[model samples]
Target chain A: MIAAVGLVLGIVAGLIYEPTVPTWLQPYLPIAVVAALDAVFGGMRALLDGIFDDKVFVVSFVANVVVAALVVYLGDQLGVGAQLSTGVVVVLGIRIFSNAAAIRRHLFSA
Target chain B: MSRLALGRLAAAARPRATRGQLVAAVLCAALGFGLAVQVRSNQVAGLSTLSQSDLVRILDDVSQRTARLQAEARDLEDTRAAVTGGASGSRAALQEARARTRTLGILAGTVPATGPGIEFTITDPKNHVHADVLLDALEELRDAGAEAVEISSVGGEQVRVVVSTHLVDAAGGIQVDGTLLHSPYHFLVIGDPRTLAAALDIPGGVLDVLHQEGATGMVAQQDSLTITSLRPAPRPQYARPAPASGR
Candidate 1:
């Protein structure tokens, strides 16, 4: 119960705390946002299994977080935040589809 | 009944685990641990990073991006040179070069500080380039292989330039909207001087017209030109026009 609360609060905090994304990367905001959600799903999947590979989970988690931050950072930096965000959204979309597939396979496949 | 239940419980305790379940278990544990760490780090780093000066980070990011852009611009310039020099009369290559040049030009116009290039001085008799004229000049220069262009007196009422508009002016001078500019009408255009000059001089061009009108326009091919951003003016948005009805 405590952990769940902490997770909720942490997410809320993250939402409240704005990242310093560049103007050029503004478009990627949705991408990062979506990617973040996908990352959480992926993270949860790993967490659900008792035998978890820290390496895989950590690496992907870091990549997802950093990339999200980077989309904003580089976007803000280049003044093409929107354009960069578009690119980020494209990448996030691919990740989302892949994650969704994994979820479907895991939950539904016999 | 108690003894039988005890025996079954003992047997169930030793039941074999499936590989799929085993893998899932491990993965889930790992994710739990990793998430714990991610949360911690995010809390620490996110707060710290946010608390830190964003402007400084922004400047650093800008500098790094500028370096990358400059390199890319140089690469494009070299490719263009090689293509032109091959003189294969390859329409495809020329077209590609032209297309890339225009794209780069538009990009450079958007981020004037990104590349190492030249400067241009466009003098307005009234101290401003007409909207149509400014856009024409910018497009021509880009087509001519200008990697970047900076106009003066941008970022104020005196100057305005967006993707749609051709002309921009400041209170006293003109700007292309990326950088605040001043006159003797300095236009910092970055690219190959000779080729760029020829591109501007194409038959029946804006440059020719400007020249015919005795406007002060000079293109200085430079080893390097610096483009920096000035404070942006508050952007304007359109509202519904009020209807005109007789009271």
Candidate 2:
């Protein structure tokens, strides 16, 4: 219940404040969001599987975002930014889907 | 031994929900919040309104517009250079002299002119095409910016028709510089074809007057109308160039 309230508060604050991301950071925001989504799904799956760990979840979330952004930056330097962004999105999307399927199985017992 | 050791290490590092469930929940909440915020901001950024093809089309349109504007600018620059550089003393004097010679040649009807212009043929079946009607046509053509004019009788020699010196003969044929032109006079004019045609065809204009006089007048535009009849330069016996006055 506390976690649900925190999420609601975060959403209300975000809507009311409407903070703008810095221009230099704009390119990385989409990738970071995708990575965060992957982490959230993985955490949810772990929770259903009885292995949920806050430390592991937070660490993985931060690491996922940071690593995704770094890969994109490296791709830009190597003149393959678009290709690498696609690659990253595909991998993270597959992981999210698998975790979501696992969570579904846990909840439905199907 | 290596497989047993690796399995032991993985087992030791694995997380248990019983110990860190609260932290896990908090982190999951944060992740959800961040995702929502990113999605909202991206929506507000307005990049989603344009698809990839739209962006490419916009880029192409901008490039084409730039190219057209650059070409116009180049043309304007060339005109500016021509005006400024062509006005320097010796070049200016030469250009002035050439212009004066051309004008004098046109007025004197001694030079052939070929340009977009109009031609008109007046058939005076009853010899009712009077000198005044012909004069009116000349005045109208002059007002309409006709650079050169020639008139010839049906199947006769073409003559440079000068307005100031031509007269209508008693027999109703036009006489220009001792040459008698009969009915069915064909006029060749060099000027802006549209303007010249409009001037002659205006309501109650020269064409109307000619039609009233029982003369059939027909005007047509030509891409290139040539007037080749040359007139002898008038020998001025008295007027001579004055000596240059000293400052």
Candidate 3:
């Protein structure tokens, strides 16, 4: 419940502020978002499984965003930014889907 | 995946608002903020999803369309020029045809002609000047580049002389083109005056023959004279323009 409130509050704050992202960071923002989504799903699954840890959850979320953005940045340097971003999105998407499936089964008993 | 042993032990007796939930809330907050920002940026740019190859293909298509449109414009311009210039082209053709008509009228002796030329007067008191002698004089004038000629009897009749004019002796005079001509017969000719006078004064020329016949011939140069004699345009009876030859 608190996590959902925080997510809503952050979205409202982002909408109100309408912050200007710098040009160099714009390319990796979407990839970071997808990675963060994957991390959230994973955290949700762990919580339902009764194995969630504060340090592990926080570290994984931060590490997911950082690593995803870093790989895209390196790809840009290597002149393969488009291909690398695609790869990152695909992997993150699969993880998010599987975690969401696990969470769905736990909550619905279906 | 193996459970985090210390985390599993800590969460064995789960509590509300645990530290893990607090951290999860912050991470979720960050995730939500990122999602909002990426969504806003996507709406603003709207082109980041397109690959470089796709953009290049679109550019190539637009360039080809522009080249085709330019060529079509040039073709339309040429067609307009040809259509609008039609009147001027016809006008030029009409002017050339009129000029040709005037030239033909002069050559056919159906129009009065004027230029520098000589006047030849023969006083034949005894009617010693015959048709053949007059004919010889006309031939000499033509050889000397006389462009127009008319034979006129003083205060009598004027007859325009052409290439096919007929001459014959008659009662005490000469009949030219069925018109009786008595002395003094005046010949008004259009040509180079100096050349015509030189041709007449050559040894064994017209003046010499007239001198031997006891008839006197006089030649005078004039700067400008108009032969007012105009011939009736001839209607060809047996001859017509050939099929393929320029006039």
> How do the candidates score on chain B by TM-score?
0.38, 0.59, 0.69
Error of 1 at B205 (Å): 2.2
lDDT of 2 by residue, A10-109 (tens): 6666676766766666667778878988987887677566675667877898899999999988876786776788899999999999998887776665
Per-residue CA lDDT of model 1 for A1-110, tens digit only, reads 22233345555554555344444433343444455566656654444333334356546655775777676676667776556666777777887777666545555542
Interface RMSD of each: 12.3, 9.4, 5.9
TM-score for the A chain of candidate 3? 0.96
What value does the interface RMSD of model 3 take?
A: 5.9
| lDDT digits (tens) for residues B86-129 of candidate 2 | 77866879999999998888878877777889889999889987
Q: Model 3: how large is the Cα RMSD against the reference?
A: 10.2
In candidate 2, the residue pairs with backbone N, CA or C atoms under 3 Å apart (3 or more residues apart, or in different chains) clash, namely: A54-B24
Q: Across the candidates, what are chain A's individual TM-scores?
A: 0.58, 0.92, 0.96
Candidates arranged by lDDT, highest first: 3, 2, 1
- How does candidate 3 score on lDDT? 0.86
Candidate 2 falls in which docking quality class? Answer: incorrect
Give the range of the ten consecutive residues with the poorest summed lDDT in model 2 chain B.
Answer: B1-10
